[model samples]
Target: MLRNRLTRISAALCTLAACITFTACTATSEAQRQATASKPPATDCTAWVGADRNAMLPGYLLPRAQGTTGNAKGPTVCVPLLLTANQPPESYAGGDYHISEFTADKLKARWRDCKAEAACFQRVNAQIQRWLPPNKARATRSTGTVDPSGRIDPEGQVDLRKIRRPAFFAKAPYREGIAEAEGRTYTVEFTVPPDAFERIDLKKTAPIKLRGWYLEGTGVDDGKGGKVRALALMAPGGGGQLTAIQHPDEVTLRTDAKTGKTESLKFPNATTETMGQRWWRENLHALNQAGFDVLAYDRRGEGLSGGFSDTNTLEQGEDVFRVLGQLENGRGLRMLTPSGDVLEGNAAAGRLLAGMKANEIPLVLGGYSRGSMSTAWAMTSNYVASCTFDLPEVTCAAPRGLRNIRGAILLSSFASGAGYVGDAPDLADRNLFLGGMAADHHILFYPTSETLAGMHRWPAAFFGKGLWDRAESLEGTVAAYNRIRGVKEIVLARGPHSIETWPESDRRYLRERMVAYAKTVVVGGRTVPGLPRERMWKDFKGLVATTPDSWEPSSRPRTMEKATEQ
Candidate 1:
């Protein structure tokens, strides 16, 4: 039924203006089909990917995430939850499978048995909603006050004249991977005075200490625990539960960059016990159980750290750099004990970061949504990340190094360009995703490098996103996949904007794929069953109209020109 509604991406790409109203991968025009050919389905991209009900993960993964809800449960646990340098929708919608396809025998039958097209659509939609946990509705990004395109004014602001933005950089992925390595880290460095409530600035290059929880697992308890640790965070949860907790050195004071006024904003700071969101808590535990010590924290400005939040990828990448520096610098991080009544001053240094350099542990640079943008930023580059928003043209070339970063995991990546708006955007149900679609962040591929060394970071990667992700378009993610030139695997499933929002089945699947990936590239010396080993992805074009992602680009087109035509 969906196949009839879907058209090839080749035609969709040719029709630029209409593509915005819907997703790019699933066009609906019969005439457009004749214009061009769609890229190969995802099945052709790699051999490991099977139906949505199948697993592309290691069999040995059995984690016990102590405190989580939904699919993130148990020791044999169900499941849960990418890469960088940069960062999709559907021309190829309509996956034949569902996360619950095989599990719910009756529900699957009901969906499959109904012969009436319209009646079945209604029946399946209603039943699907009833079977899953209710989705928790979160507030969307404010369309007012701040326009990503920077087009309209706040409409209510008192003055726009006096305010200034000394620090700003073009969204990095748009440039593909040019001088992104050298651009401003887009992060601010400062110190919190125990007495004074305000923060003091040093420079951008200096490392900013971030507050997070670290658990050792790669080795036999090192008298304390293990040395080899891994890092994996949540989808773009803006701040931690301690969102109300302000950074001790918050110089920005949560002010609006445009009007120079205070805004009621908070960071995902740390508490004595909890280091991340529910999803974070679960994934952290999973990695620890998987034999890789896990280190996660409140990102700068988002939690109990200094500076402000820009939600930029390079900035987040720099944040990763700073935290890694603190871990390896021998300064010894202040750790809170498992008991709320804690201890401090590297008491677990032997277990966490004792006599060894932190870089020795191959870590995966990652994030979701805006977080994925930081993937490329974590790579080897001549340019140290610097953001001149506050102080114009300030260089932050501090001694930042994490040479052993083996891979990246980008979840629901950024669209390299402003993709399709809507087939009929004026309608209420029309998808109006912004952010990744922000014209300023509308990056495209122009980089000429096709070698692993030329990439900003190492090339081993696992890129995954949702077919239902409204924040990013399918075309945009392909652009991101195209930017990276190395061994990479791309996975598309039907879920929510963030992994936390996904159901247990989908979430469990994500965990399996993630653990498989972490074990292989981040920890090294292991190849799990069903692990993806594709070299690169081919470009795809289409106007998506809502369907599960079931296809992938072929490894190569028939000819060289066919590969580059789109």
Candidate 2:
């Protein structure tokens, strides 16, 4: 039965895939030439220490960003709530905040008198909450000091010993589950930076500390063909051990073939292809604080990954695929499913093909702006399950793959046209589009950006050849989305093009829908949690009325929504 269902899903998805001619969708003839061109080997072994002795800084967390749990118990470890550093002002819940490093000694000594885990930590958690903005921007930083050798100075390590009992839960399921693979009872590794860790000084009140670090083992699969994982130690500052942090997330170093120079790639950083990678790296320290095993790299033509020639979405996909291939190459951080479960990349692919796949943990494909659309296109294969598309679909066919996709988290999906009759007749049926004359349906419209310089328009650098750069009828896409048989284009509240533009409630709501639906469709069939129907009317009005000037619709509408419904 499961196999049958998956087969059906694949068939439906393939229907979209098949619409394209072999020549149209086929990879560039340069695949062989590019394949032979040995990418500069990735650099290895550049380590960094978080302000907190034992923890690793600059790591990202999994499970989309969530807000703090007020009235909570235990130490409040400040984890990054957002993914990118250039997040919109609205991404934060709304509060005055600043960055500072806290030592383990401070945390341990603060809550020295608390006996019960709950009471002791609750006081401190509240204090930390006060420090953050209501809808806080997820803190990511690339501004830390670099050593003379150009490697990240691994000095700011989070100490674990002083971590008091009862760690606070920022997001749901805060308690670390039993280490499925293997490890100790008190798995204390990968804590946040001291600056990120804060405790409220409540006199005569028991203080709070993080609930020790969890051991995220090594050699996990990267969802393609290899394994990637990290092991590190984090602790509180105390006992003359100011610099006693050991083993941070593995810093990979490979010599550039062309440059013939060694480069260091942090496992917990985002793949630097464009400015987005820079934003991701800046937050690794913040993400590490939040208990995420972020594995980032430099894709082709960007950062350490070489062989980039005027990069496009397809080339970017191959670059990302290589990272997975690297992880599966038996080297780095592995990809997990929506449920926090790990899988061998090869096995995962095989299972996907066999239709015996399960979503134990979230294997998130996070793309910022342009990358988001690329991620969506990449998932048309068996590689990824959940993707976060940040910009509007530049091309029409990109959105067609949504039907069989396990999760589609569109930060800003593009579909601003009169209707679905522009270019690319092939995409007409794939996108869940509505007719030009249809009544106002609950369409998934992306909001225009109020921040970022080029936030409103598609970047010209991305036009390689395919539909991405080509003009397609948004009308067709809108029609496809409306009629497509899958999750609706669930719109979050008015977040600008960046997910950061929307309020945390709005972003959280969207994430909840994505995660929940991911769990059901990808993991096991189950209902996802949050969907704000009440806000639909307001959201709808806001969407249709606000036409983003950034999106230059195809000239001479083959199809467009009628200005006046009549």
Candidate 3:
């Protein structure tokens, strides 16, 4: 009987051991399941097949100035690709191609005639090589010097390290090659299915549904013989409302002033061609290549976006708030129209938002001319500060004050409305109020000295010379913002009222300043190099006192009434 009791006790112990093992395994599996559920889904790119050229690739056509003409060219096709961890692909030269007229048509015909996937890929690659060859001259080598103590020397004349063979150059033997195939234009090719090529119609009017992973290289140094890498998935571009969760819900309808009929507003979407052109014009893509996820879009009624182009500050603030909310929550934004139309949100956009949030990317809001006002209003408006958007089963809160914004770039800003928009309030007081509210964020202002000249030549009807002269002087504006800890103003020696029309040197300077400021304030959390900080206000005041009497408004009293009427 004792032997029987021992056997029963041993069996009970074995049973308990098995139960504990099973429980542990079950818990681990459940944890993994939860993690997988929270992760964003992979993007889908099958809808691009048989889509219109514009719908498939928005912003392909260049925006021509009035009365200006160019050689007739065929439709440009831009294929977005996915990038690898390796350096840029062998086919890419970090430049754009303005192919001769009809070159695009021949390329299109070749793409249509190709039967096999490999053949099609080869054809496209060949055309790209023929028309847009890699620019070897533009390729730059990483050059820097190091001291004996292993610290980087900013003033060193010679590079201590002999690795001048391009930092991205792979050393043979240990070098890991780029995976899969390389796109003819960029580093990595989008893993698009072969069959999708046959389905692309190019002539269809419907928008293409394409999504893929894209790696944008930002040539920022890691302070230790390495470069910083940042990636952003490409969003669909064109003249329509954004369906992606990464984008804000766009206002679509507005009453036409002439007919009083509610009509769709058009928004400009950045396409590959236009993106390249913009890179050439504004160096915007260079900013992306420099490590920032640049999201260039037209405000509600501007560009190709469908909506009443209204400049109501409150509505603009609301729109910016929704975008901020989407970025924070990784969710789609719900936009209710004045017509009571509830436009549904997109899941893909939410996934993109989730990815950005997961990466902990910061935002830098920037604008030029009227856009400056929009950005400023967005920062200070009550609507944006307190607004929230309803996601599908979740509530996404808007940014509190300027909490999410790390910096603001106001180029040729009319925030003060001092001399241009009519008998407006003192711009100096308005700037002080807004600047105080965003004390923690960095603000960079680029005011022009040749605004009077620009107004007399091109925009004279809208902007009076007196108004332009006063606003562009930036004396009061600088003094008002000088008290803010992060505020800094740069007076361009001679630049047009329109930032877009500024010379290449001026534009380059602005880009460098912007990048440097972003690096100092956001990445390094330090003071900007070469900036006069508190001393600029006093120095500028002295300069104003010594300036010619002609620059003063009192010297030209006759124009004051005319300026006020505007």
Best by TM-score: 1
Q: Which stretches of candidate 3 lie over 4 Å from their true place?
A: 1-281, 327-360, 382-399, 417-473, 530-537, 541-566
Candidate 3 lDDT over residue span 175-251, tens digit each: 21221111211211011111111122112232111111122334355456665432222221112111111011223
lDDT of 1 by residue, 1-566 (tens): 45532333223222321222223323323213311232222221111111121222111111222222224344322111111111122344322111111111222233344424666555444533332111111111121212232211211221212111111112321221211211211111122211100112222343344444455554412223334445443323444421121222222124334543333223222321122243544554565667655555444444334333233334455456545555554243444333322333344333344245566665666556555555544442212222211122222332233556666776766423222211112211111112111111221111101111113234566667754344444544544454454445566643434554344555566677776776667544443347433212233311121112222211111222221111
Error of 3 at 11 (Å): 70
Global lDDT scores for all candidate models: 0.35, 0.25, 0.29
Error of 1 at 313 (Å): 4.3
lDDT of 3 at 445: 19
Least accurate 10 contiguous residues by lDDT in model 1 = 443-452
Off by over 4 Å in 1: 1-209, 219-236, 240-276, 303-313, 330-332, 339-351, 380-401, 415-457, 523-528, 531-566
